[model samples]
Target: MGTGANCVQSPYHVTGSTWQTTSTHFRKQHTPHSLMFVCFSVGWVQGSTDFGVGFNLALDYGLASVYLENGTTVDIAKVEGGQVYKAAMRLNDNNIGMINGRTTYSRSEQINFKQSFLDNYIYSPNRLGGDGNGNNARSRALSLMLKALKTATESYLDSKISNAEVVVPFPASESYLHDLRQAVASVSLHMPMSAQPPTGIIAARAHGMYGKCFDDLDLQGHDKSMKNDPEQLILTIDYSRAALTALLVDEECGVFENRRVIHDTRLGLNGLHQLGSITATDLLETALRNITQLPLDDGNGAGLKYISNLVIIGESAGDPRLHDTLRRVLSEQLEPVTTVKSGFSPPIDPVFAASRGVAWDCWDRMNFQVNE
Candidate 1:
C-alpha cells in the first residue's frame, strides 16, 4: 500500500469497529507529552522589489525544535589512542550512492545506511513557482514544513520519554485550517512510522485580525432607521468584507471571525461601535488570562494551552490612531501577546493591494457567507 515519492498513501478501508480501533490506537500512541510548535506566514509582493510591506507573522510556536530524519555526515574526526580517527566532513552531504564504477563500501553496509536515511528524511516533490499549481511552490513549501515537523517530533521522542506533546501554530481562519489539515494529511500519507498518527498538536494564532475593528461603526458604518435594515447591513458587510480581504492578502493570512461582521451590522451604529470596543478589550483580556494559566514546565507547554507569540497585521496599521488602539487593546487584553512593531509599511505591495481590495468588493457584492 506504499505509493512512490509523488503520491500519498490512501487511508486503509476498514469496518466500523476497525476504524474506531484505529482512531483510538492513533490517539493513544501518537499523543505527545511535550508540544512542538510550527509557524506559517503568508504574504503577497509589494511594488517592484520594495514589495511594500508584507505581513510576516510566526506560523508555529509550540514545538521546541524540528528534526530532519536523515542525518548527513558533515565531518569525519580522527580519534587518537582510544579515539584517534581523523577525517574531513563534506559540506554538501548528498545522498549516499555509487558515483562512478568504484565500490566505496560493502554492499550490506551501503544498503543499510541508504534505507535508514531514506526513512529519516521523507522525500518531497519540488516544483517551480508559488502560484498553487498542483505540487508547485506552495505545496513544496508545505511539504518541507511537514517533513521538518515529522523529523523534529521523532527526534524529540527518541531522546525523551513517551507522552510528550507537539504543537503546530497556524492562522485560525477556515482557509488556513483547511490548508494545514491538507498538509498534515499529505505527510501522514507519505511518511512511514511505527507509532500511530501523531496527535496533541495544538494550533495557536501567530497573528490575528481584530474582529472589533471590523465591527466598529467608526470604521464600518451602520444605520439607525430600520429594525433589521438590509441597506445599512449591506453597507456594513461591504466595509467588513473589504477590511478582512485587505488584512488577509496584506497581513499574512491573519484570522478573524466572520460572524463578528454580521453581528456588528445587526447592532446598528452606536450599538456596533460600543460592542466592538468591548469585544476587542475582551479578546485582549482573554489572551492574557490564558497566558497566566500556562503550565510551568518548558515553554512548549505554554504554546499548547495558549498563544505565546503575537504578530499584529492589517491595512489599518497605517493609521496612527488605529495602530495605537490595536496596541492598547493587546496590552489590555493579552499581556502575553507580544506586539512586534512592523512600522508604517503596508503588508502587501500596492499593486496587489488594489486587486485584493477588489476581490473583497466582489465577494461582498455577491453577499458571501461564512458558511458558504
Candidate 2:
C-alpha cells in the first residue's frame, strides 16, 4: 500500500473522475447524497444503498434511496413516505402513491404493480458498519433491521413479502449464509440470498449496458458490431464501506459469469470513519494489481488482458479521488497497450444500480409465474 495519503484534498480541486461522471461531484456521494420524495414501504437503508449489503453496519439516516416500479431510483429525506437520518423509510402500503404530494393517485399517476407484489423497493447505497449500535452481537442488529422491515412492510401491505431477496457479500462463508437465512426465517420472513456479484450483473442486464446476452459483440458494452469481435470482459469494482471487492466477470450470453474475485477488507470508504487517515491509492493499487494477476480458470477465454469494459459501483466508487486513483493504477499496473474502458451510463442511479437489477430479475420471474 502507498503508505496512505499524507493529505487528502477535496474533490472540487480535481477534474471529473472519468469522462462519464456517475453523479455530480463524487465527494458528495460520501454522505446520503439522495433522499427521494416518493412512496416507499418496508425498505431498508444501512451504510450504502443496502443490498442491505452486510451486518450491523452504521448508517447515515440523512438520505434514503429506493427503486420504484419504472426502474427509477430516488432518495427521500426528512419527509413522509420516506425519512432520512432520523428513522427508517416508511410508506402507507395502500396510500403508496402520491404520499404527501398534491397529485393524488389519479388512474394515470398510479403505477400498475402486480397484484401480489409491492410497487416500491429499497436500495441501500453505500457504507455498512456500526448501525449507531455498538459492534457486539452484530448479527442481532442485522436480524432486527430485517425484522423491522418485515413488520413495517406487512403492516402496510396487509400482505406478506412472499419473497425477500437479499444480496450478501461475494464468497460469504456457508455458516454466515445459514445464519442469515435462519434469522430471516426466525422473523417469519423468507429471504433468498444471492452473492453480491450477481446483483451487479442483474443491474447491468437491466440497463442492457453490457449488451444482449449470448452473442458476439465488441470488446465493450451492448452496442452492435459487425465483426466477430472478442467477448467483452467487464471488471466490476465495488468499493463499499466495509470492504473493496473486484470481480472479474466474463459475458456468458447476456448474463455474467464470475471468473475471479479480489477482496480488500482493510481498505474501504468507511474504515470506521477513518476515510482521511488511510491512503486510498496504496490499497487500490494493491487490489488492482491482484486483479490483473489472477489467472483465468485454465484459460477458458480471454484473460485479464482483455478486460476492456469497466463497471464500477458502490458508494466509494463515486469518489473522485478513488476514481482518479483507479485510472492511475490501471495505466501503471496493466500492460502498456491495455486501455481501460470508462463511461458508464446506467438507467438508474448508481445507488440502486444493484437493487434495481435484483428487482428486474424478480419482476421477470413473477411475471412469468403469474402468467403461467
Candidate 3:
C-alpha cells in the first residue's frame, strides 16, 4: 500500500506465535539489506535538553514533515528511511500499529486496517480518538507519528525532543485542537497547553516572515523605496487543491502586527477548463484589490496601503505555469503604484515554507519564552 521501493508491511518480532513490539535498536541486529529501515540511533550521542520541533502535518497533503532544531542547527528528520513521511498507518482492530515513517508491523491483516489517518478524520472525526472518538486510536496514530518524528529527529540530532508546536493548516474544530494536544501527551512528548491555541496558517506565514528565507534575494519585485517604510501591507495567497485564500497583513517594521482574511473562495479551483489560468489569476487580482483598499493601522480607509509582498504557498503552489501567470498578472496590476513583490519561488516555497517557518518560531519561543 506504500510507494517506496522497499515498501512492505512493517516488521514485528514474533515470540512463538505471539507478537512483541520492537524498538529502534532492533535495526542494528540485521544488515542494512535485511532491515527495512535505517538504524538512525547508531552513532549519535544524546544531548542535555529536549529539542524544539515544528510539525507541518496537514493530513490533506497526504504526508507530514518534522523540522527539529537545536540552537544553531536544524534537522529535517528521516522517518521510514525518508525525510517526508507517509500519512498512512497500519491499524490493529481499534489500536494503531506501526506508523509509516516510524516502525513497520509485519502482519498479514495489516493491509486490512491500512488507512490514512486524515481521511478517517474527515469522514469520522470521533473514531480517530477523543471528542466521542472512543478508542483514541486516531489520536494514538498521531502520537505514534509524533514518536516516529522524534525518534527520527533524535536519530540525527544530539538532543532529546521537548515537544512540538503543531501548525494547523487552517482553523480546525475545537475537538481537533483538543485531540492534537492530547496526542502530543500520549507519546510523552510535550506541547505547552494554554488558553490560546495555535493560530491558523496566518500565524505560520507571519512567523515565516522572520526566517532567514526572507532575505532580499528571495523577495520578488522588492522595491528599494518600501525597504525603509516602517510598516507595509502584505498579501499572502495560500492555495491547496486549486482552492486559494488571500490574506492581508500589516508588517510593522519587521513585525506582523495586524491581519485580516480578505478573500476565501474556491474561485481559483474552478479554472480546470478556463483559458490560460484565467480564473485563478482573476481571483488573486480580486484579493489584491481587497487588501489594498482596506483601512490602514488607524482603521481609516482614507489612506489605502498596498501590498508589498505577494507570497503563495501550499503543495500545488509550485506550478511553473501558475508562477509565471501570477508574476505577469500582479506586475500588470501594481507596477506603477507599487510592485507586489512575490514570494512564490517554486518547490522550496511551497514545501518547506510552513515547516521551516514554524520551526524557527518554536526555536525562538523556546529560547526567549515569547507568548504564543
TM-score for model 1? 0.22
lDDT of 1: 0.22
> How many angstroms is residue 359 displaced in model 1 relative to the true structure, after the best TM-score fit?
36
Give each prediction's root-mean-square deviation over alpha carbons.
25.5, 19.2, 17.2
The parts of candidate 3 lying over 4 Å away from their true place are 1-51, 59-141, 194-229, 240-245, 254-258, 262-301, 332-350, 369-372
lDDT of each: 0.22, 0.37, 0.39
Each model's total of backbone clashes:
36, 30, 6
lDDT of 1 by residue, 199-313 (tens): 1111111112211222235344555332321100000111110121101110111211110111111122222244567675454333323223322222133322223334323
Residue by residue across 35-114, what tens digits does model 3's lDDT show? 11110111122232234455555433322334433434353642331111222222222111222122211211122223
Error of 1 at 214 (Å): 32
Better of 2 and 3 by lDDT: 3
Off by over 4 Å in 2: 1-139, 151-160, 191-198, 211-229, 272-279, 294-304, 332-347
Shift of residue 174 alpha carbon in model 1, Å: 8.2
**Candidate 2 structure quality by residue, lDDT tens digits, 1-372:** 011111112211000011111211112222111111101112222112211111111121111223334544433221112222112211111121221111111010111234423222212211233233222122433466566554554454355443443443233333334445545656654444222233344344445544333345343565554344344556666555545656555553343444445544455565424644345566666666655553343245544445555666555557765677667666633332321122334335554455444433333333333334
Candidate 1, superposed: residue stretches over 4 Å from native: 1-135, 159-182, 189-324, 327-372
Could you tell me every candidate's TM-score relative to the true structure? Answer: 0.22, 0.54, 0.52
As for lDDT, the candidate ahead, 1 or 3, is: 3
